[model samples]
Target: MTKPVAIKRRIGRPPKEDSVETSNRIIDTAAQLFAAQGYAATSMEQVASACNAGKDTIYRRFPSKADLFGAVVDRLRAGVLENLENEINTIADSGDALERLRHLAKWFLSVNLRPEMVAFKRIAMSEAVVFGSAGQGQTDKDPIMDRLVGVVEDAQRDGLLCGDNSTVIANHLIHSIVFGPSNHAMLGGKQYDDPAIRDQYFDQAWKLFLHGAGQ
Candidate 1:
């Protein structure tokens, strides 16, 4: 009798060989659990089990459950908003600010109001209630909010907008665009469901913003 044919197997990503690789794997797994279960309800033991990592591995990287939760938040924040932050800064500084604003309005309602983003924003706020004193470097800040405000300030200088408090004006514009539509979408509904409707809404909102801010 011949020996059994050799079994060929393709292994997955090579076993974690370094600290950074290990930390990333843990954070990715932790983010999914936290998003689905919320912070207080999740634990390090669960994270270790979910990631197929040992408790010792997790503890060595994050000494506490809160630390792990904080890592999850940071990772989620970067994944969700980093690109938008960079894009807004570049577009705002590059050309006709009002035209940029119009383009941004269309793009914003189209992408940022999607189900995934709305879900993240809603759950993140609820979870933050219990994020008390974690000492986690602020996960993210009203992502793109400051950049939008700066754009408005630039628009004012160019006389496209007339406003004394650029921050307040920015807040009004951004909030009006995001909150109501995103709120509807979060509950299982906006632009995300239908692009035509979203564009229609954006056109009206954009016109109104320009009319009011130009005054």
Candidate 2:
């Protein structure tokens, strides 16, 4: 009798993921869904299913749907800051401050004009109106803003752009060039989807930023 061959079962817990891996997957998945469908449309179940994770696993990391959405926004904000930092690192230690400002202005326009980012921004604004921020921190003190301020300060140090208030300059750069155009694009303004038009807007914004900085 060829006795019944013993069957091996896959081990317990199926190899636990470190907390960071699990949390990152959840946050990334949530961010994509929220960006695509908006905060009101995305659900925790959809996020879990899309990530191939269990609902309980997601809930363990994010106690509520709003918490999950907030995590996604925080992660996106961090990623944008990290990219900005990487771009800053590419500049020579004694690089042109004006060039740096132009690079940042271009980057801001490109990122904001992205469809997914536009959707995310719209969703964030809506969520902010409904639930008051979805746990994102004050934009004034964000690392990205800080980095922009640093760029302005460096320009001041080089006597390229005289400004005693880098923070105010940074705020102006963001609101005028980045946020204003982004809002217009999000509203489906004419010619927004055209690359030539986008380039024109970016160039105009760059020129304005340079002038505003006293260059």
Candidate 3:
């Protein structure tokens, strides 16, 4: 008669609270890597190593490098949108549409000038139009831009803005306050760390646009 031996499998310990910290570290490492090196150049292994995590851990959280990069982009986008929304909501006591618009422009500049945002925009622009069609047909209608448009529409209804097309005005305002400055800095190899510069640009842009649209 032959005797069979049974082997017991060992169970792994549950992940600790530091699991979330590790995940965030991986994400942050990926963001920096992707920003320093283009998305096509950055690798999941590098991200894992940078985060002091295992390859399997990265795969467990994000299936692929592309997936992880997409998540990073999404986080940056959502953060910018949330900051802008909070700024807009704070305009409740501005007393007039023009002041609110000024506040909006200032807030827009403040948010856009952040290094993370600038890096995200740089990454998006480097793809040279591929990023434009990655989502819905409306390429220009991101959550943050949509919220800004809503604000512009409200301002128009309140007679703070005068234009046959509110959407067009909103686009122009966003381009001027957000994309224009960021693009300029990115193209010129300039750092946008100084709040004073942002405030100055915001003031000038807001005043010019308000003057043109004011009654």
- What's the TM-score of every candidate structure? 0.75, 0.82, 0.77
Model 2 / residue 197 / CA error / Å: 1.8
13-93: candidate 3 lDDT, tens digit per residue: 436666777778888899899888876688898898888899998998888766687778877777777777777777767
Q: Give the best candidate by TM-score.
A: 2
Question: Which lDDT tens digits does candidate 1 get at residues 26-122?
Answer: 9888878776776767789899999899999899889997787767656655664676676676675566987776666566666667555565576
Candidate 2 similarity to native, TM-score: 0.82
Lowest lDDT 10-residue stretch of candidate 1? 132-141
> Among these predicted structures, which one has the highest lDDT?
2
In model 3, where do residues sit more than 4 Å from their true spots? 1-22, 129-141, 191-197, 212-215
Stronger candidate by lDDT (1 vs 2): 2
